[model samples]
Each structure stands twice: as C-alpha cells, then as structure tokens.
Target: MEVTQANILETLPQDMIVEILSRVGQNSSDQLLILKSVCKSFLKLSEDPLVLKRLSLDRWRLSPWGNPKLIYLFNLCTVFGNPNAIFCLGLIGYFDTKYTDLGLDFLKRASNSQLKEAVYVYGVIIFASHQIEAKHVGLQILNETFPPVPELVVAVRIKVFDLMRQLWLFNRHPFDDVAMPCPISDHDGYFPQFHGFEIAIPECMSCFWAYELDVFANRFAYN
Candidate 1:
C-alpha cells in the first residue's frame, strides 16, 4: 500500500482497532507484540494486563492453537514471577463454564511445593486486604485441598507480623490499610468467629465459620 493508504488505515476507529487487535491476539503468535509496538493505540491494548495474562495461559479448551499453552503459562510464572499468574491460571475456568472446577483446582495445584509459599503470602494478602472480601476468597484452596496446611498458613501469618514490624519503624505507625505493609495491623475485620481473631489465612478455622467458608467452596468448586 502507498504511504497515504497506510495513513488512512491508521485512522480507523479506536473500537475497530481494538477489535482487530483482539482478533489477532487470539492467534497465539508473538507477531501481536510487533504490531503493538508499532503504534500508541496498539500499545495500550497490548499492555492491558488481562490481554497479556490471557495470552500467557491456555485458551479455554480452544485446543491445538499453539500446542503448548499450558507449558507457556507455567514458564511465564517462572520467568516474570507474578502471583496473579496463578489467579490467571484460575481465570481460565471462567472462559468455558464447564471448567469452573479449576478454581479449586488452581488453588489446590498451587499447594505444590513450588506454589505453596506464593499461595501463603498471597492468601494472607487477599484475606487481610479487606475481611469482608477476604473472608469470601482467602486461601480456602490451601486449607481445603491440603486441609492440614497449618504450618504454611502460620508461616504466612508470621511473615505478615514481621512485615508489620518493619512498617512501624519505617512508615512510622504502620497501620495503613493495604494488601500488605500494614504493621501490627491485623483484623479478621470480617470473621469474628475465629475466636474474635481476624486471622487472615488462618492456622485453623473454627466450626462456626464453616458455613462462611462455603462461599469459596461453591465459587472455588464452580467458578
């Protein structure tokens, strides 16, 4: 195409551009990266975390595209090292309704020796970030799948304790609300039944909270 033709194509509607990019993204090829770097609009779409995240994982049962999407996701987890990688791993189930069981499976698989520590820290972060939300989706996978993951859970709790101490000395009072970095700042703000203790990941769950735990069970077991 001539330079003028190329310039005209570049003026396509933003919506059309995004639509084309998403369609091309479905191809599972690195060529998408090249196109992204060629223009501002394409770069923005490509950088969307969800886009890269989905590209990094297997397409929901959309078999044989690249023939190694699972390995690709695992390799990505190893390379860039994002805790959310596991979450994205779990997100695949959302694409194909039939695979929702992978939610629980994702967490359970995370208990693999390699994934345990990440699970623990992330679990506490998720749980304590906000008890209401935390209680709904904490490390139920680690607890339910391993059922006896007290040591791992407790370790994460202790790490948070240490982190809190660090915050007190630096951020000065350390009681800032956050996923992590709140010092001595603990609250089961949502689940009082844990002995009136707001244990995030939990060394153990009391009988009273069993029903509350069901939230993750169904979501984990299904979505």
Candidate 2:
C-alpha cells in the first residue's frame, strides 16, 4: 500500500497532527494556506486554535492599507491569541491615535507572553515618554528583556534587531515629523553619536542599547 500524507495524518493522534501542521510552512501563512487547500481535513485542521496560535504572519505585510484578505487572516490569528499577531496589532494600534490605548493593551499582553520583540518595542515606547517614573519602569522592562550577562545581552540584542528589521520592512508608513534623539545623556560622559547607518558604541551599555532603540523607533517613525 502506498502511504500518502492523508493516510499518515489519519494514523496519528489529533494532538500529533496539530503539532505536525503547526510546524509546516516554517510557520508562514502562505505555506499554511497551501496546505489547507490540499483537502477538507487539512483545511479544518489548519483552523484549529492551536495551529492558528502557532502561525507566524511575518511574511504577510500587515497594514491597514495593505491586502484586506491577508489583514483579515492576520486578525483571525490575533483572535486566536497568536503572539506575533497581537504584537503586530499593537503596533498598528499604537500608530493610530484612536487605538493607542488598545494598542498598548495588546503590546502589554504580548510582552507578558514573553514575546521579545513586543517587550523591546513596548519598553522603548514607555522609555521614550516624558514621564520620569515611566522611564524607570521602561528601563526595568528593558533590563529584564536584555539580561545583565554580556554574552546573553549580545545574543538577545541580535535576535531583537533582526526581528525589528523584519517588522520595520513589513509595515512601512510615512510620518511628517522625524524622530528626535532622547535628551538623556550617558552617565559615563561619552557623547552619544550615530555612525551613519550603524549604532555607535558608547561607554555605558545601557546608553548604547537605549540609543539603538531610539534609532529603531526613528526608522519606524519616519517611514
């Protein structure tokens, strides 16, 4: 007997099937959509809450001005509590004046879910505020996100940077105002500077990381 994919699926338990479907398409929505079209069972399994929550909508350019169908699909994932979806929705909400509060709520939920990108973005937004107490809380959140150990900090920063870059490209928007640098200076007296497209190193690691976040925020702000 020639064993087919459907045959394999039928032989496996439902939980195991869900795990397999969740892993398919490298978490890409496009690949998952293809899988869904293969048959009715695959289509039904694709919408399983577990599968939806695990789906990554990164490949889809999520924007109010973008593809409506894709946006709807992304929203469906968000309804299923997909962290990436929640994070993206938070960004969209944060940028729009009407949905700012709701956006922050989404971001907070994503951050609590241990989504590193959400934590970094949410922390930066709070840190960038004018309120001193908020800044302290933001700094604390950032500290927890990046960790104190040098090696771990480097690894987390690298991952966060890549995630930010992808997100920046995924949702590009234009703003009239340019992003201004934070007024806070380094405690070590090293002048904060920008080295063209790269983040300049400063004496204080905190200052350096904060500067990087400011730059990331600026990129999103300007375009």
Candidate 3:
C-alpha cells in the first residue's frame, strides 16, 4: 500500500490525530475548518468534543465574543467539561445584560476549577456589578494563599497593579443612580450595578491579564 497523506493519517492513532487537529485549530481556524473537507477521519477528528473545546478557546481568546458558530462550539465545550470555554462563554455574556445571570453561573463553575483567570475576571465583574456576593468572593481571592510559585507571584502582583490602574482610569466608581438588578434567587437581594458602556480599558486589561494566566495554564499542562 502506498504511504499517501490519507494513508498516513489513517495509520496514526486517534489520540495522535486529535492532538494534531487540535494544534491546527489553535494556530489557524481557517485551516482547521478546511480540514473538515479532507477526509472522513479528519472530519471526525475535527468534531471531537476535545478538539471543539480547544477551538473555542482559540477562537475567542483574543476577543470577548465571536460569530454565532463559535458560540455554538463554546456551548458544546461547556457540555464537555471545558472550564476555559465556560469562562469564555460567561465573559461573552457580559455583552448583553440579559445574559449576565447565566454568565455569572458559568464563571462560577470555571473559577471552581481553580482557573485563576476565571476567578479574577469573575470577581471583577461581580464587584463591578455590585452584587453582594462579591464581598465574600473578593475576600477569598484576595486572601487565598497559593504555594510560592514565582510565576503566580508575578501574575498576582501584576494583577493588583492593573486593578488599581483600572479603578483610577475608569468610572467604575460608585454612582448615585441604582443599576437594574437581576435577582439570582429568592433569598438574594439586589444592589446598584454598573451600567454597560463601551468595552473599556478595564475589560481590555482584564482580558490581557487572563490571556497571561492562560499561557501559564498551558505551560503547566502541556509544556
């Protein structure tokens, strides 16, 4: 039998094919989508939950939102236990007030996975939204001690500095007018929330910071 590209891909193990396809998806969405037309094996590999999860991460890593197709992929990833994708979906929820409640829950699950970026982003949004729960969660994140890893130490210090800069540059400060409230539960009470404005400096800074954390997570897991 001739060792053609199709033959070679078919000969590789499913795990190897998935990893290769995932890497392709990460580097180039256009190329990754093109692979769906390559062959049945490649098509199947592209549709795997794991691959879709990674694709979703790469799709929305730079921006807070994407087209409907990426959102569909993210929804699938959330079902497949991709915490980072969950966080992304939650972050996207910020685009519309109607979705903020659901977004908050998604962020909560992602943070519980010990994703530091999720924790920080979630805390910032809730705090900015002025939810009372932010008080407790904020205290936990500020106080929670992680082992002395130099990278995390550096990330945390940078995070604090960014937070201060954001506070100073943006009017995320308290306002006399109360924000529209989305009640989480019967027992929960509402507070004045921050209204939506343009995707401001604070969000961009938080996004860059989250990307930094993502780099750390990838390094620890894959490198």
Q: Global lDDT of each model?
A: 0.43, 0.66, 0.54
Model 2 clash pairs are none
Which tens-of-lDDT digit does each residue in 107-166 have in candidate 2?
A: 998888778778877877777665668767877787777654434444555654554543
In terms of lDDT, model 1 sits at 0.43
Worst 10 residues of 1 by lDDT: 166-175
Query: How many clashes would you count in candidate 1?
Result: 2
C-alpha RMSD of each candidate structure in angstroms: 16.8, 5.7, 13.2
lDDT of 3 by residue, 28-124 (tens): 6678889877788998888787676566353344233456776666567678777777766555553333566786788788777766667766654
Winner by TM-score between candidate 3 and candidate 2: 2
Q: Please list the residue runs of candidate 1 whose C-alpha ends up more than 4 Å from where it truly belongs after superposition.
A: 1-6, 48-223
**Which candidate wins on TM-score?**
2
Q: Which ten residues in a row have the lowest lDDT in candidate 3?
A: 167-176
